[model samples]
Target: MPKSLKSRGGEEELQCGPVFTVFAMGTRMTFVTEEEGINVFLNSKHVNFELAVQKPVYCTASVPKNIFFTLHEKLYITMKGKMGPFNIHQFTGKLIDELHEQLGNLGSHGIMDLNILVRDLLYPATVNTVFNKGLIPTDKGELQEFYQHFETYDEGFEYGSQMPEWLLRNWSKSKKWLLEVLEKNITHIKAYKSEKDNSVTIMQAVQDVIEMEKSELIPNYALLMLWASLSNAVPIAFWTLAFVLSHPDIHRAIKEDIASVFGSAGKDKMKVTEDELKKLPLTKWCVLEAIRLRAPGVLARKVVKAVNIMNFTIPPGDLLMVSPFWLHRNPKYFPEPELFKPERWRKANLEKHAFLDGFIGFGGGKFQCPGRWFALLEIEICLILMLYKYDCYLLDPLPKQSDLHLVGVPKPEGQCRIEYRKRI
Candidate 1:
């Protein structure tokens, strides 16, 4: 039998023996030929440190982790630079407490408030995202009024004639919900009482930091927080449930891991302690694999300034995107890149490479999502509950990718149906 794999130098190599090996960038692939085809196992050494230092982003060949790590370190410095880390942590804790208390006994009213709160967090960032895309100030007032009168769909359409049809449709419904909650909640109502209120004040503070402000600030920031909650969490829950329903071995592994963590403690209750949740490694790995395969936003970078590279020059104003979807599949890095293998993450030395330039599932550099830690924890919590309690699967086969792009994230075609069964 002949076995073939890409060598470390990226050249194809063939071995007539049962096992053939290819080496590249500190990792080697050993292929064993079988009647059906070849099964390959990947092993890595320590050349990642050098490879990372050589891979260029913005024309600088710094170690990728160093770039991400340094950017985050500076973000910490700049964010808390004024108030101090302790104070920032305290503020975050306070918000977490409030959010937890509100979510604790969620009724319809509470859901409305929660939705508003999420929107408030989203508005500023959301506006900034659009504003950065060239939404001008004159456009801002009409946009604000469009959202204000959004509940009256026809009125919103009449007022927002300058906006695109899709934007108008999306915002009309969203603004109606926003107004409903803001009208109900004293906090939100007061937050934007006047153009000069604390909402604007807070928006200015955010603007000072993020460097943009439109009347859309509140809505945009609210959208940012909402995206963090919805974009990853929703899809992850769907896939986790689908995979658990279809893969019993994986399901059993997750259940056993969860059981071992909170044994006899909370069999019936949905709540588990944070420490106990961290012990579910198998569950974490399942979600990681799912996200690696399914994450929608390819990491985005815009050239803020132009520079000359070794051979050529990229002019300023060019946008650059690096996708983990492809990089994660590069046969040189992952031996069966398409296979769902969670253990790859748990294996030592893998962590060192997981967050590098090519492996940016959550994005990379200073601008990477600050809420990643919270996002991961939330995902783990939700996955544990679903894996422990329900059996689920896709009602339809995996749909082909579509053209609907929301803030660079993909939207599924219409609605997806899934079948769920109670697990015994």
Candidate 2:
């Protein structure tokens, strides 16, 4: 399914102006391009999220129909409570520890793979923040072993949904291992009490459901949650750092922002608070720019009632889609559409003006991601840690945003390396 989506890479749709239609997997998909139509597509009472994602999820994510409906409800509620802006600062301590530990291994200077560096650092840090540190082995060698299977699982996720599992032995093995790990994590969480403070993590938030065994589908639920949450966010972090570090002026600006908020690194271990994060509008703009530039190529829904959008009627049951990748590129909303310009955001009124209309890093209206706050906060801190601790820039040619994404921001493609030296 991801391969099919990648095949065209929005080129065919770009020719169709605001809207077009295509048939895939026995479904008619209406792709909405302009912000006006996108606004309608996202908010129409007739258009919905669950029905739109059910099939692909069942196929690739191993979630069956009976449990799918209830599982998402549970997740959505938990996500709102755990990942929302109200208490976003809670996750920073674990994230700081994890990022510091990973980045510390650089030992002052080295060259590294852009993809591998981000993947290894983000995955366990994410896992620990989302679940618990003990959920996966913390030692470097053992953690890498676990992440290897997760890598395979993540890499093959799209194909795994459509193709037979038997054909992809490696992804199959990795999927099994991931399920077992999640199941064990669930069991362990249910049996144990926190030795530390009583701040609720998502795993603990869902303990009632897992403990009662109301659904035997707990493992698959955990796996899907992991993928959906991390898939876009981790790559957004990669792009944010890539764009900032490669541009010396932006890099310097980001560093200055960090200096004002957290003081200089190396004097003592740098600590960040949520209030301090708000001070760095430049850093936030840079991060938002990466998300805008590398935003997901598509989002989808199923129209349940006939709806009129852009002088045309979209019939019920047709799969409706929108391309933020193209909407963000609309020159009226964003001048010089192809360039990475963080400064543009500063000139515009983000709330009252049309800028927010074009910003679809999270989805629109009712379809907006519940994890939006968590994802943004996570990226900000990761960027802060990187700039605070290292002097880094690209060594090889800069990587282009890969068309290889299944959802959210695509990963960086092409061969690229970084020359980074520890600052502290």
Candidate 3:
């Protein structure tokens, strides 16, 4: 079997042999093929690997230089302080209201592109939760425009980091516009800090950090923060919905689980609480399974010091990559790895199977995604509301995952459409 995975340009390739190098977007990266070696490298204290944002080659087109160094500590503190489980529950409730309104406007029966609808539902909810409700676009056309620009910038980053500046000029423009909007919102929040009781927002925390740091890179940091909060969420939600609805038994089981947790309320009065959501084993399992199957395939780290792993001498300055997609699918950890079985996460089996050790849906250690808890909370709310309120069916076959990028979540090759009707 070939060790190399072809790059987008087709001229360059990623070598995934026991230890091989690849030039990605003009930067050399080394991938560790063995699971034990990869685990050691990830958890090693002597290896001295820092976040990729600290390096230039991995920062991509729109990111500012040294932005991570300047903002990471403050950002981590802010996320930890503001995006706790209680806050997530409150914000998710608000988002559920918004989703219900949007669904009401769409009426009982309709065929729509799943990705587009999910994007529309999640983008506003995510922005409002992270920033404030005021930041959500009021005009339908304006919201669509913002969504398009965001998609462009996200897809551009996913495509490659080494593309010529001229080729990425439009994406840069979109990023600039996004940053400007974030900056304006941040400034507005700062100016009205005394007038309004808006202390819960992540934006407010960011403003506090900016004021304390007195950094000139507010817009740049804000852009990255916004991307972190919003990206990957909608696609994850879409995949969870698609997968659950496509499997009839799984769909019925999830609905029953939701009912058991929340009880049967009136169609207009169904309420999902934080405790109920937390207690839902099957729903959580389905979401985790979806993420394991489709989330970003690779996590990259740069070696700051030479290290030896499994008898191979890894030199300083080489990039080390580990892939969750590979580990999650390893049959040793997950029996019948290719099948979608949420029961694998049953409480009795979790510890016995050592699921956490193998699960990298969110990366491990200090660099793990800060918003992961909130992400799961938001996904739970969306899935529960969706299943409880409406009958949904995939109008098209399950879309295959596109392998265009070495990192980032797998996207559907084409639009996945679904039909939804209000439950009787």
Candidate 4:
């Protein structure tokens, strides 16, 4: 047996699989790959997991500041009340308009980098949807600066986790910039009261919490929420479009599905509502399958007490890691997991297959991503309009997955190019 597969008891116990451990930057971490072991850890009550507080294996051993954790907890609570499917659907419509305007500027036909297109459309649209344009920076340079800071902070999580305390102290520049942006936005909203006439945005909701609790951490919470809303969205959108266009059958079926639901496509803008989008099963399935294939990241938890899972005894104070990227491809749940088969998600087949239980692309249990439903709505709307209004194809073959970062969404090894021509 290979050394990688040998368990703590050696090759004789390879059937149990090895529980790999690595020491990085003075922090000890455990990596689990078996399906049963991960499921047990994720669903276990003894395992404690807090997204903002947990010291992810990739980051320094120091715990996040108390204020940061408080901000996250409060924001999560506030989002439960403010972010609903209805609100997300309404935001999706506005997002469609913004994307339409931007795409129009690109002309009728040309080769474009898929990553750039996805970022350009999502960044501003997400800001508007979450905070309203009145609160965000109006200056293009400031906006660009903010975006660069965010990317820097996000990319740093991979290496920062392995750095010591002295290096970690220097990592606050990105956090400071993000907080400054949020503070300015909050001050603007308070002074102008612009959110009074319009629907309550996430910014306004966080402001309310700040007022009620009299906590200074609200601005940081707002910044965290903004990051959460923007981070994984672009990658998910890119993969969804890439996979749909890569497969001839899937692409044709999606276009036909859009035509059936929205009528014959033409020069006029395609107005698709959330209700209408729900009717396109194949389109939704294609997006789900894409996520299962390309979305790679791990769920980290710290054991608060000694726990026994899958006949292995795990000690208290150990870091536990589970990767959905591996779980989603498990042969026990998904047959021929490498293939892109949207039909596997059909209603009748889904009922018979227990694969749904194995699908943890969005995490699981109480720790499940709060923005999941909204994320799906946003992706579906983008895919629907792009397919309906334009004819698009891959200009470059799908690149291998790279940058499997510990904190953020994974990206293609290199740029995936695509060509688009407006359909009239």
Candidate 5:
């Protein structure tokens, strides 16, 4: 076991397999060494298990396969069927249609208005998803309070002004509905509060958590679920669509795949079943490739305490930022890093780009996002439908990377408009 970084007080470790990583806040340490772009303090004595509230020592922790195993356990425990409320159904399907209709009515400047429509459809659905599970009061006051505390505490926001404001505003509006749901179903949520009861129903645990931390954890956790579930899917959809429209080869391959799976002409309306979805392997690979090219948001961990790095000692309270954007695009792992090739995912290079281990799109460890399965399913369904139902193209000549505050959280730079004509 490699001596992983420890907290300043020499407490427990992050336990990323043998190589531990510590993150804390306000720990003043040089970000990078002369040789390493960021001098990650691999082993610090003070590291703890808590989501590092601040920066600890920046170091690359050896994440074992067990971390992934733990993540799978946590993911199943946290999010399984709860995605319907996060507007995955609406945002991925109806909302896109609504946005298209809205654009038809409102036109280009509708981008400003979109900030409203998107929130209207998204926030309430998100709050209710949690509230229905007995998570929190969706009341305006409760939500406002929740928003206030999260803004002050949670480190997810690197650009406070850009992301938090949007999150808070939507939260404020949806609070009342959320509260009503919680009030209606309080008893069921309480049943799952005990941590000792590993078999506790996930919904109950979620509710118990919110009920316990009405202040920070519940509200932010609810919102974070929404962000994690949708953040990559939306931008991924935008880019994937753009790619389909621009790349004739990809378009042809996908069309062939779709036709082979279902049929060729006349059958315009097709609801993709789980089995039919399995057949669209090429389409799935294309979506994956698009994510590789466009979705590379950053992940940050706060150090709960501090420890030592080499000869130098790092005090407690600091943050470590890792960019999977760089890792995902590394030429060493992905040959011709800039190229968009779905063939890479085939069995020959199955070990390429780091296994289920290095991929940060859904994150890793116990703290990884829970709704990844939902997100992936939703992406697959949406892409399948778009490719089948219509011929679409990007209005702009040069498609640019979407602006996601964090890695994989992508928002198109311009109002991403696609000219769609029914495939006849």
Candidate 6:
């Protein structure tokens, strides 16, 4: 049934009933899109985030079953603590240096795949920011290759989750490659961190929580963090920049806004500050709008305890799923369900910048993505830097999302080439 939904493109498959039901491989799942059901799906104490994600998290990663529950919950807190504003503020400048380093490799005028550019920029910034310098190769070309392997591993994630890992040998290899690298990074940091820079990394924090004898779990946990931090955020970055560049008005307005805060764009590097980054409403809105349109089509959580939603009583063992793609399309909350209007955010019913109804791009409730602010800030930084340092326009039509996948930020269906000239 999930395959049927994945094989078929567009909304018709998702619009079947008030509460859609799917029976796949002995798993019973209920999908919710309406107001009450959606709230319960997101906010219900019965919904279990770790358990729902356990299948995929275990399948794709090397994390052993015995420690999955403890490691998953512990790392959730680790990620939240490591990516919170204080940690992010410290790494902002370093992350920008990584981004600029990649940009430097792209000459003054060229046609480049926007997807590749996003991967090249974000993969290194995230890896280097969360890991020590020598932990992973910091060179742009090496990082690009690293992300390519991750794409291969990620491409088979859903299928791997549903089926056995041994069935997919090649995907398994990619996973191994990633884990090996992560393992080396963790081991090196733990062994030599005190002798060297002694600067703490996210992965360093991760290494601390895990037991010394349970060393096999190090890379597995590191892999989990890498996937959470980069997998969706990278594509979301692509979509955000693509959306803004597609709308000339929005692009120009955000450019001017960033300039007012960061000063005029020149050959010199951008001097970004957290306070200045906070001043960008338009840039922030465009990122939100892109996320609204291209967010994960389905997010499934386990119905741990019995919960009533949309007239149905979800039992303890069932799965509850929500579609941010369809939810954000509701005209009641978003007005124009399909159109990309960054300004709609200004008029929505928002508490603490979250839409009370219909929207859950960063997710909702206490279990919202811990890297939410960092992800947004990362996207916005990319937008401002690219927009400020270069005059970029899509050389081809904006790429569309692969309708076949629904788990996370969908990768572009094809390459969208962008031609940019470095600002004088």
User: By TM-score, who's the top model here?
Assistant: 6
Task: Give me the displacement of residue 312 in model 5, in angstroms.
Answer: 7.1
Model 4 — TM-score against the truth?
0.85
lDDT per model vs. reference: 0.41, 0.74, 0.70, 0.68, 0.47, 0.77
lDDT of 5 by residue, 253-343 (tens): 8888988987864453445655576677777677777766665555544455653445444455554445555556566567886777777
Local accuracy of candidate 1 as per-residue lDDT tens digits, 1-424: 3444332223464545443334543433332322111111111121122222222221111114443343434434443332332222223322333233323332222122221333233233233321221121226575465334432432232223234445656545654454343223323322333322222222234334433322323343333323343445545545544455456677768777876765532344545554465476677677676666555533333334443332223334333333345456666656787667766667524323243223556655434455454445555655665445544454555433333331222334444455445454
Worst 10 residues of 2 by lDDT: 1-10
Q: Give the Cα error of residue 116 in candidate 3, in Å.
A: 1.2
Candidate 2 residue lDDT tens string, 91-180: 777677777777766678888887677776777778777776677786878887887887788778777766788999999899888888
Better by TM-score, candidate 5 or 4 = 4
Between candidates 1 and 4, which one is better according to TM-score?
A: 4
Cα displacement (angstroms), candidate 6, residue 253, comes to 0.5
TM-score of 5: 0.58
**Residues 105-208, candidate 4, lDDT per residue (tens digit)?**
66888888998777767777777767777545558797677768777766665665545435655455776677777776777654443333556666778777
Q: How many Å off is the CA of 141 in candidate 5?
A: 24
Every model's TM-score:
0.53, 0.90, 0.88, 0.85, 0.58, 0.91
The C-alpha RMSD of each candidate to the native structure, in angstroms, is: 13.7, 3.7, 3.8, 4.8, 11.3, 3.3
As for TM-score, the candidate ahead, 1 or 3, is: 3
Which residue runs does candidate 4 get wrong by more than 4 Å?
Answer: 1-18, 55-65, 68-74, 85-87, 134-143, 161-172, 189-198, 347-355
Q: Any residue pairs clashing in model 2, and if so which?
A: 60-161
| Model 2 stretches with alpha carbons more than 4 Å out | 1-14, 139-141, 164-167, 191-196, 209-213, 347-355
